[model samples]
Structures are given as structure tokens and as C-alpha cells.
Target: MNKKLFLLLLTVCAFQFSFAQKNLLTDFPKGYTPEEVGKRLAYRFLEGKHMLHGGKWISYPETFNWNGALQFAAKTNDKELVKLLQDRFEPLFSTEKALLPIKNHVDLNMFGSLPLTLYQITKEKRYYELGMPYADTQWEVPEQAKPAQKDWSKKGYSWQTRLWIDDMYMITIVQTQAFKVTRELKYLDRAAKEMVLYLDELQRPNGLFYHAPDVPFYWGRGNGWMAAGMTELLRCLPKDHQDRPRIMQGYQTMMKSLKNYQMPGGMWNQLIDEKDYWAETSGSAMFTYAFITGVKHGWLDAKEYAPAARKAWMALVSYINDKGDVTEVCVGTNKKNDKQYYYDRPRHVGDYHGQAPYLWCTSALLEKDTK
Candidate 1:
């Protein structure tokens, strides 16, 4: 063999071997299988304090993240996962006050969603009984605090009546879960009505929803809440229901807009339409879940959108560190019109916002892969 050709071949082999060593497929989390990745995330949550948005473990909103874990548990029927959920909530079962942080805040009623789900899975009366009042009181119109008609002034309604995009999930998921447990149509009706009302008020011509009617910023997680909330409701909502078509249209349209905004690396910007804003984990996971859901339901084209979901999932997992911490998550944000505010918001590793969506996306991927 010629000396020049032999040297060139030796150099190429050495470079290839170095590349393999750097990016060994095995080095990327041992289980890329959605179920395994999902379990790793859940175990991380269990090992840490459940605090995400606030310090309170048993409250209205933050518990929603826990509830996502519970949903994943129910989907998999894993005994260890189920035990983790039961152990977390079993202490709160001793007193209604312990279970409910605020007696009358409808937002707080969202905490009941998990209990109802637990009741369905475990047949425990305490879980069912605990959740019933919140489901019943979720929609009672409160007397205006000072007889002024502003949404913030109302007690039970808190931002519920204002059609904020965040309320899309905050209100609907609990109500829909109530319907699932009791087989009552009213719970479903109220959830559906509120979703349509919000979409009507806030959905922009581009198909993405504004953070709120007054706030024009297309915040990533706010739109995430809207997309995930609609997907949740449609899971149990009846096919022939009067509002189904409209809700379907809104979901598909928002998905189209979301597809447009996804960055080449598979994550979305903190302010979704802003090119220079940072790619965020929570929003990216949510979109991946929504895309997987759309493809499963026949609302999206599998050929075109599945690769997008796969890409987003790949990007999302890159945020998970060796200890299972999901990084690059924008912390709980309020609606701000300033683009700088959204971009400047703090990002945290293992923030509950990122953890919950990472679990959700993994669960969705697992279910899709099995089919």
C-alpha cells in the first residue's frame, strides 16, 4: 500500500473513534424510552421538595404540577409512582382545611383535580369526598368586593372570568377531571364554555393567543397553558358536543402558529414570536406534548408533525443533567407587555414548571410509541 494512502486512512479512523467517544449514544441518559426518562424525572421530583412556584406543597396552583405526575402514574399504573402520589396527599386527607389552603378561591379548587383522579384509581372515598366541594363551587358567581365589576375584585372568580390565557388550564383541567370522575355533563359544559369564551376573546389572527386581552405579549407558557388545557378537555369531551368543532379549530390553529415559532433547535423562545429571546424548556415540552396529541387524534399530520415532536423532545432532554434536573426553565411569570421583561425573567434548574412538562412529554411519547 502507498504510504500517503495508509496515513490518510489511519488519520480518518482516529478522528472517527474520537467522535464516537465524545457522543456515545449510551452516554445520553440510559433510557431515552419515554417511560424510563419519565420515571427518572418523577424520582427527581420525589427526592426534592415539591415546591415549584411557591413553598406550599399542598395548594391550588403548584399542586397542578404534582397532578401531572399523578396523571403519568395513572397512565402507567406503576405501583411505585402510585405510592408516591398517595404518600404526598394522604396526610392532607386528615382535614379538609389541610387539603384546601384557601376555602373559597376557585383557583385553589384545582388542587381537587388530583384527589378526584386518585379516587378513580384507588376507589378511596376520602379522595372523592375531598374533591366534591371544589368541583361544585368552581363556578358560583361571587359578589363583587366593592360592587365594581372588575375581574380581580371578585372572590371566587379571581381571574377566572377575565379570559386570561393562564386561566385556560388553571380552570378547565379541574372541571374536566370532575366530569371524568362523576360522569356529569355540567362540569364538562362549564369547562368547554369558559375555554371558548377565552379563545374568542384572546386568540389572535395568527392563531396564537395573547397572554391576556389587555396584554399583547405572546408569552410562551401562557400559550402552553392554553394548548395543554384544550388538549386535556378534548380528551374527555364528547365527540358530538356542540362546542367541539370550535374548540378543535382553535387547537389546530394554535398548533399551526406554534409550529411556525419553534426554533430550529426544537425549543421555543421565551417570548415565542421574538427571534432573539431564549429557547425555554417548559414551553418546548408543552408543544411537543401538544404535537404528539394532535398526531394521535388525527388533528395533525403525523408525517410532518411527528418529526417536529421528536426534535422538540430531543432538545428538551438535553436540558436534563446527570442528576435529572431540567434546566433552562423560565420561572413562573406574570403577564408583562415588555419584551425585555419576558427575556430577562430568571431561569432555574429543576424548576417544577420544567419538570412537570418533561414528564408530560415523555408520557405522551411513550403512549405514541406504543401505538
Candidate 2:
């Protein structure tokens, strides 16, 4: 390591690591337990009507929240909850078929993840049959694809590759689910290659990501998407896979920045480096999920990161209201060069954007039997 760089990392690591010595993490005091919080949020999501884009198609945030709920339900063996989630999806095959998002854009295409989860739980052929197309069509250039989209496919990337930071998660999850079900390399391979390109193009010297090429600001949720996306992909990436090294490197690099940027209040801001901005729960939860998974998987030094992850979870719980909605969640945002644009993004409650990652953190904190 470079002398100055080693000194800088050491200083940051020492500051982040100071915390309680006993248990590291233990049973939650009350409602904060993964079983408690996870079920509450999952049920809260169930209580809502099907959320759609343009009130016509199931929205990506809803799909993302649904996937998190499914994973949590499976991990906790909540068969009753699973039935509710499946019952909700039944409409899509019939009365709500028109509401199923088409595989055109990255956001809409990720809706396939919901049925794929259903397939994993129910082993229904229709679920698998319904879900795989979204993953396949991402790389299968359509007649509607723009010339640049076609060019991307010709170069072995998704037609939907717009180099947006958010695409990291949208493209990764559905394909990861496909790989999980079919044990196929192509799906995972496509995601890995795409991730490396995004890392090369977007990741900055400080290990944070710019939202887009022209939009050079670091929006919290944008980085959240990348953090959780990389964690998800790297977990499933085989040890010897060609892209693992680079992906893992990117993940670790980003995590160090996350640790350094984390607020003393155990949260992160809407603009991560803008410490005075309001603490954003959605991004905070996403980073907590990543840190928890990293520590548990031995991808990070437990002593160095476990305390930070644990503190983040405790802080996150403080933001959840009695109704189970996490407060102060930065609503869905677009990239902009103006710093104030990020600072002024609306803070919403119970938005699936916020709800999804809380469930993911619940699942990560509770994971024991699975690796």
C-alpha cells in the first residue's frame, strides 16, 4: 500500500470500528427483531393495493419490495406469509395480466423477479415460464431497440444498458434469480460483465459512483442500488468466476467509502457526503444490508465492520414508525448536476423504495442456515 494511503485507511478504520465489546450483536430488544420487523413490514406491504406504474403496470419498487418480502418469508419459514404473497400474484396471470410490466426498460423488466421467487417457493412451471423472458429479453435486442441499444448487444451487453447507476440493481436481480433457478451461467455471466463495465465507467477514485456520465452527483439511493446489487451478485458469483475479482474489488472499495461516510448518528445522508442533509433511511438500510452480508460472508473484517453494520441496523429501526413505514426515506430520484436537486428530493414514508431494503436488512441480519 502507498504510505499516505495506508495511513488514511488506518485512521478511517479506527474511527469506524470503535463500539461495544460484548456479543457484538444480540437479540433485538423488542420490535426490532428481524422476525418482528420483517413480518411487520411484509404484512404492511400486503395491506396495500397493487402499486403500478402509470396505474397500469406493477411498479419496480413494489416488485423490489415483494422480492425482499419473499426472501424474508422463505428465510423465516413463514408459510402463511408466503401464501399471502402468492395469492397477491395470482391476479397477474388472469385479471391483471395487462398489469404485468413489459420487458422493455430495465425498471419494468425487473418485475420478473417476483414470479421467479414464486417459482422457487411453489415450483410451478408457469412461474418459471412467465419470469424467464424478462431476463432473456434484456440481452435479446428487440426490434424497438435504438441503434445504440443494438450496438450494446453486439458488444455483449444488454440492450437496456444506459450506464445508469440504478441499472446495476434493476438488471442484476432478475438475471440473478434466473441463474438461481436454472443454474445457468449465461444469465450470471451477462450480469457480471455488465457490472464490470459500470464499475469501470462510473466508480470514482474515492470508491463512490456518479449517477451517470453527464450527471456527476452522488445521489444516496443511486449508490444504494449499486451497493445492494453488487452484494447480491457477488454472493451468487462462483469463487473462480472470471469477473469475481473485479466485482469483489469494486464491492470492497465502495464499502470502505460507505464506512467512512457513515454518520455518527448511525445513518447516511441524501447526498452521502453532505453531512448536514437529512438522514435518508432507504440508503442507510441498503448500506446496512450490504455491511451485514459482507461481515457474515467474511468478505469484510468482522471486527472492523460488524459494529458499523450493527449500529446502522439499530439506527435504522429508530426511523421505522409504529405502522412499519420507515420515515425520512428519500423518494425515487433522478440524477442531476445541481447539488441542491439531490438535497431537495422529497422524503416519503412507506414508499416501496424504502420498504424493500428494510426487508433485505432483516433477511441479512437473520441469515444463519444459508451462506
Candidate 3:
């Protein structure tokens, strides 16, 4: 009688422990590891015919969406995913009308280098040739990133640049890609300096950069651009270069600040540090990608940061609908000094901005080192 009762008690205890573990696992999405969820999000977003903005078939930001999937494919050597991205990009080769000419602002075609990347993979000259004009334009510094002083090019440089944090990616991603194609030191240096100057102006004492020095909103997507851009640049920047440490310092600082603001649910607010602001997916995805990459490279303490980053990835996955659309992304925003403006900005599901960052987060999480 005593032996039978003891066995029954042990069985009940085991069942209780199993139930509690399931509850703890709720922080992540069910039936998917971080890698699986990210890949699912990428494939889902790709299934849509109009993943681009304004119903334009393809645009600069959408290229990042494709490029992120491509990077993921490249890292995992997922041949099927690689083919899918190439097929998606095939329509661009059909016509030249959507491709921005060099006369346009370089930022207008921020992902112009995607063709160059495609060329490398497919050995198709047309893709490479299409990117040449865009590559050449990187040498032309826009007035936006140029310092305001007439002597801006002279001996002592000041941080009085008109650059918004968004330019960090818009300018550098294009330049870094050009460097990859040309092996030109100038492109690499230009990308690095763009980051250093922007950090000088926009990085606050708390380690987070502002949306703009004038605006100071720390708008979620704006900071997403910065984190995503810097991470991209660091991947290509020369290790021995002078600007590497400075940029790393800024990146580390930004990560530190972002760590403090992440919500328990794994999202950052539309206004970052503001508690009342709505949590956003695009920014959280960007931060997760950056942080996980940082941990992979030893830039972040993996023990402390990885868990939080994994949580953020889970929260990000929760935003994806069955259709692969990311929800709660802030729509395009203009510079504003008012905090309320950021808080009240409209959010839309399946926007190109959201899709691009989600791909990036998925790709980053899938990297071998992140495991």
C-alpha cells in the first residue's frame, strides 16, 4: 500500500513540472525555434506579390528585403531560398525605368547595390553593369551628409552635418556594397567616416542616437536604420582601420542603451525610452539583429544579451500574421521635435519598412555564430 502511494505522488509531481516548463516557454512562439520562426517570416513575406511600398513593384527598401533573404541563403547555403530571391529580383532586369539614375539623390536608391550582389552570385553581367552608375555615385557626397561650414573639407572638421540617423544605412550600405565590388579603399573609408561623423552628432550620452540632432525623438525605425546600418558596415569595415574602434564604440554604446529600454514582451517602444509609447516590431527586429550579431562577434556579452535578444526575436515573430505581414510598424515619419508626434504616428501592417527589418532579423538570427 505504501509503495503504490509513493509512485502515484511522483507521477503527479512530474506532470506539474512539465506544465510549468511549458508556461515558461511561452516567451517564444510555439513550434518554432528562433531560426525557424525567422525563416518562416522571410518565406511568408516573399510569397506576397506586392511586398514593395506604394504598390510599386520594387523599390530601394524592398531590395533590402530581398538582400536579407539572399544573405540568409548565402549563410546557410540554402539553394532553394537563393533561387527564390533571384526569381523575385528577375522582374527588375525586365525594365530599367524603376532604377534611379545617378543624377538622383544617392539615398533614393539606397539598396542599388543589390544588383551588384546579384551579379556576383549569378555571374550575370547585366546585374553588375546596372549597378555601376549607382556605385560611381557613392563618390559624390550629398549636401545632406556634408558639413554646413564652407570650409567643411578643410583641416579641422566639425560634426555640424545635416545627416539624419537614417542616412547611416542609406549612404553606407550602398558604399559598402560598392567596396565589395571594386575593392576600393575609398568606399570603405567613406562608409566608416559617415558612421563616425553621425555618431559624433547624434549619439547621446545614454548610448542611443537621436532621430536627428534637431529632432531628438529617438523614433524607433530611425534608430533601426542606425543599428542595422552600423551592423552592416562593421561586417565589411577593415579591422585595422582607424575608424573601426570609434564605430565599434558607438555601436556598443547604442546596444547598451537599447538593452535598458527593451520591454518585457521583447519590443522597444515607438519612442524608445518612453514607457507609454506603443511597442514596435521594426525597431525591435533591428535591435535583435544587431545585438545577436554583436554577441556572435564578441562585441556583446552573450550571457547577458543573448537571452534578451532571443526574446525580442520571439516577440517579433508574434507580429507576423499567417500571411507573413509584420504588424505594429510605424509608417514613414518626418523629423519632428514633438514627442507626441512619434507616439501618435500611424502604424500599418505589411509595410516595406517592416518587411525589410524582419528579413534582416531573421537572417541575423539564422547565422551559425548566433547559435
Pick by lDDT: which candidate is best? 2
Model 3 C-alpha RMSD vs. true structure (Å) is: 7.4
Candidate 3 residue-wise lDDT, 1-371, digit = tens: 69989999999998886454333323345534645665765676577654443454355666677777677667667788878887877766666446433434444556567787777677778877877667555554456654443244342332222468877887777778878877888878877877888899888999887888789778888898899888988888778999999999999899988999999888999989889889988888889889878876767876568777777877887888877678998887878899888888999988767877777766665555522
Better of 1 and 2 by TM-score: 2
Steric overlap count per candidate: 0, 0, 0
Tens digits of per-residue lDDT for model 2 on 20-68?
3214554568877888989989999999877788788999999989989
How high is each candidate's TM-score? 0.85, 0.93, 0.82
Using lDDT, rank the candidates from best to worst.
Answer: 2, 1, 3
lDDT of model 1, residue 308: 75
> lDDT for model 1, on a 0 to 1 scale?
0.75
Q: Which portions of model 3 show Cα errors greater than 4 Å?
A: 1-30, 49-57, 99-103, 141-161
Candidate 1 has its poorest 10 consecutive residues by lDDT at: 19-28
- Candidate 1 wrongly placed segments (more than 4 Å): 1-30, 52-61, 95-99, 143-159, 368-371
Error of 2 at 116 (Å): 0.6
| Native-referenced Cα lDDT, model 3 | 0.74
